[model samples]
Target chain A: MTDISQSAAVPGTAPQRPAATLSARLARWLPRLVMAPSFLVVLIGVYLFIAWTLWISLSSSAMLPRYDFVGLEQYVRLWNTPRWHTAVINLFLFTGLFLAVTIALGLLMAILLDQNIRAEGVLRTVYLYPMALSFIVTGTAWKWVLNPELGVEKVVQSWGWDTFAFDWITRPETAIYCVVIAAVWQSTGFAMAIFLAGLRGIDSSIIKAAQIEGASLPRIYASIIVPLLRPAFLSVIVLLSYISIKSFDLVLALTNAGPGGSTEMPSTFMFAYTFQRNQMGVGAASAIMMLMTVAAIIIPYLYSELREDTHGH
Target chain B: MATLDINRVRKAYGNLEVLKEVNISVGDGEFLVLLGPSGCGKSTLLNIIAGLEDITGGEVLIGNRVVNDLPPKDRDIAMVFQSYALYPTMTVRQNIEFGMKIRGIPAEERAKATNAAAEMLQMTGLLDRKPSQLSGGQRQRVAMGRAIVRHPDLFLFDEPLSNLDAKLRVDMRTEIKRLHQRLGTTIVYVTHDQIEAMTLATKVAVMKGGVVQHFGPPQEVYDRPANTYVARFVGSPAMNIIPGWLLASDGVPTVAFDTPQGEAVVRGVPLSAETAHRFAGRDVLVGIRPEHFGLDPSGTVPVGVDVVEPTGPDTLIVFAAGGTEVVARLEPFDAQVGRQERFSVKAEKVVLFDPATETRLD
Candidate 1:
């Protein structure tokens, strides 16, 4: 017979041991049995997927996955390419313009709506309808309005002003501004929605306190209302940045990197190289670089913001 | 610094009338408390005076100027809200200095005023802390300090102490009373708690259902209430009101009620001859405060005790009297649950009201 103390003895109690217990074995294995599946899935699915992408970025495979390592050649070649460089520049330009214009216009619209206006429901619907539309629809509509030879230029010339030239969409130097205008048109409604929520959450008592403190309406908004809205500002900035980074469909339909690749963004660049050019190694490397760039800029700011949110002022 | 005259003011929100023909004139340097339950339009009246809410039809005179059209900033007043309403992101110093800075006060004076207000509130150590970092009581102090530093003509408070814990509320009440004594500023404060109103206000306005039922000194409002509502709303645990009939046949004027304490007669009131002649045998409400009830077994009015609650200093005896529920404050030694007891109502303190109008008959 097996010794009973081997399985069930309390190690620190005394010399005499109890008999082996079924409960002890069940207790040790219960938690592991419950947790093992989820842990294995995270390890094999998510972690391995990212690891495989990273490995592919470091290799020289095309179309399908292969294992011939090239040791940083893909990254070096990526930096030297003009299209990749132009995509990086356009990303910055689009993000900057998108953030500034959206927030400014959103704040204005939010303030106007807060004034106990009539037809408030109708006004909010009109301002917020753009967010409900798909990017494909938004891009198609703007492509018509922004087409230099067909849309605005044709209409203006018919008005008998031969000197009037609305040709920004056809010019290399000015095509990026067209993209920004359409981008703002598509997303300013979202900014307005966020800011409306934030402004509504402010206490009316504070507005009263400011007025009693001898603050005019302009001063009150500048000093008290805006300062209290920093969290809202940070949230809008992060959200608008995320949208600007993967901005593909609008660029593809409206500009198609026209006027000599002036509007090619990172998402468009990644799609072109991977599917059209069939350079999977270079595409994966570009995707990895974009991910790293976003993480490097956003993670630290989000870390501090979340910590402050949980820990408080 | 200023006298606020609210002359015959009425407020109506589309057809739901809120304040009905209210009028009051607050003298210079007086602390006036508007005491009422929620939905009584006390806060709405306060906001009207601050120029934050428009009165349907009335005139507001601050000092000598009619300020109905002036905005809140131009009204020369400061208000402390129940929520503190401090700018959550600004430091305490910045919050106190905000109004002064906007008014274009020089930096030196702004600093001096902030320091003086902070020192007075005992918040010197917390001047650098944001409002979110302060405890509830400390935040209350900061809110008050924000008002005091402005040196405005009038100060308004909207239930400023209701958010604090009980002990802290009492402490802040005393602090506010002392601050009023020191500052000597004209104030209009609103509160639902009668005790706070009594302790803080030089004059108390008791409101009900959007009308001022009574406005007088605290003792006058308590001792000689205008009507049944004033008598009941101005006291803690309220005055016991019993239904009875006014007897005017004999030379003496008295009220008669059949109580479990047996037949009780309250005398010694000089009734108006008009009321006496009109209500010869009409029903009336007899009001008596709890402290006036005595627990003498051989007294003229006899009652049976139901429950005795000891509250450290005084004991409360809930007894059946005059065919209605009556609570009497008795000495701890004189109260026992389920005991045979007799209670006497102080005859002079008995108040009579016409049952139909709920108005004082005297």
Candidate 2:
């Protein structure tokens, strides 16, 4: 009886133990299996395309990507183009103005709304509602408003002011300024929301202490409160600066490189050359330059931020 | 230094009155502590004095001038906040000199004031450090240094020691008292801590629901609280109030209390004859500090101890008196659980209050 029981137990236990181990292994791997599909998609869709684009920029690809061995010729050709020069200069101006104006307006609005004011919730929503619309929508709406005979000028003229010529969208020289106005309108609310959060995080006692120390309201903001908002300022500048560099849709929807390529940007030039002009080599080169510009701005910032986090600040 | 006066200050938010016709005045170099629990409007009264919050219905005068219409800056005061409120981005020197710089003091004078303040606070070595690098106590000192450098007529401290750990709080408390003694600035401080109020204030205004229940020197407030609320709120393990009916059968008043003795009538309860006559047959609240009770073999009431709390210095014996849980500060082993123990109140230490108004009758 003992022999039979031992033999039966050994056979029964053998399969059960391995089966339990196998199921446990499968359970451990299930989460990774579920995550694999999305991970693989992003890996190929983003990183793989980036690799492909880098190779194409180096190769001699004009009409349809002729991947011949060429060394920096496309880059050399890209730098010599006057339109590219105009796009690069426009990038500096647009980025500087966009960042400065957005931060200033956003900070001002945030401070105003923080005064324990009545109807604050309603006002915050009104200011931030523009952020919900796409940049294309902002650009299109601004285009009509900035049009000479059809928009704000026409409306004002009908109101009997004949000399009001608010027509920057029709002129190359001032077309970028129209884009700047629309861009600032769309993103200032986003910056304001961030600044407001930072402002709220400050201790109320600081302001009271400042007030009792004989500092006026303006001096408090200028000397104390604004200096304390350094992190918020950093975040706003980085976000707006890169957005300025990669501006495409706003310019396209509003002016479309209007009135002789006045508001042309790197993104616009890249699109125009790659698809319209069939200069794929130069287009890829310009795209690479844009990426480098963004990297030059962002890499150092991210490094410093990460370094501080690791240092346990 | 200044004589700070708050004349019938009334604060209301629409229909909800937070502070109702409060009044207190202090001479130069006096420390007045507004003591209460949270939402008792102590902080509100402090803010109204600091000109941080509007006085809905009163005038605040500092050094004889009514500062009713003046902004906080023009009021010539300094404030130390609970969080320290040191400018995080500035060094200790810059923080101390912020007010001076705002008043457009020359660079040399600003530097001299910063150095002098830093030296006075014994933080000369830490003058170049940012607030973030300092310990909690050091930050507290820096905050004090900032207030000190301003050299204003008055200083307002809003529960300044509350944010520190227990040990640090005690240390900082001593330091603050010393600072007050040396500087002699008239200070209006707000805190919810009874011990801090008792230890620091020359005058304490014990508040409840936005009104001052008792305003006097700390010892007077502790020994003779103006009302039952003041009696209960202003002590560590507050004064126990025994509720019972006053018996004045033969022109002498006695409060009859319940105990394991079934019921005991204690006579010679101290009160004026008019108060004794007025509440002859009604319920009266008897306020007894825990230390005023003692155990004796032939005491009036026999109490069964429910719990023992030995707090290192003395043991707290909790028992039922007049159908209320009352604690008696006792020598250890005087009372034990599940055993009947005889206790009696010191006749002279007993205080009487009318139950109807919760006010002291005499």
| Root-mean-square deviation of every model | 5.1, 4.3
Q: Give lDDT tens digits, candidate 1, residues A82-121.
A: 9998999999988998899999999888888988899988
Error of 2 at B250 (Å): 7.4
lDDT of each: 0.86, 0.89
| Alpha-carbon deviation at B309 in model 1, angstroms | 2.2
lDDT of 2 by residue, A121-150 (tens): 899998999999987898889988898867
Write one digit per residue (lDDT tens) for candidate 1, span B54-156: 8799899998799999988888899999999999879999988988898899999999999999899998999999998899999999999989988889999
TM-score of chain A of 2: 0.91
Predict model 2's lDDT versus the native.
0.89
Weakest 10 consecutive residues of candidate 2 chain B by summed lDDT:
B258-267
> Which portions of model 2 show Cα errors greater than 4 Å?
A1-31, B245-254, B265-267, B277-282
TM-score for predicted model 2 compared with the true structure: 0.93
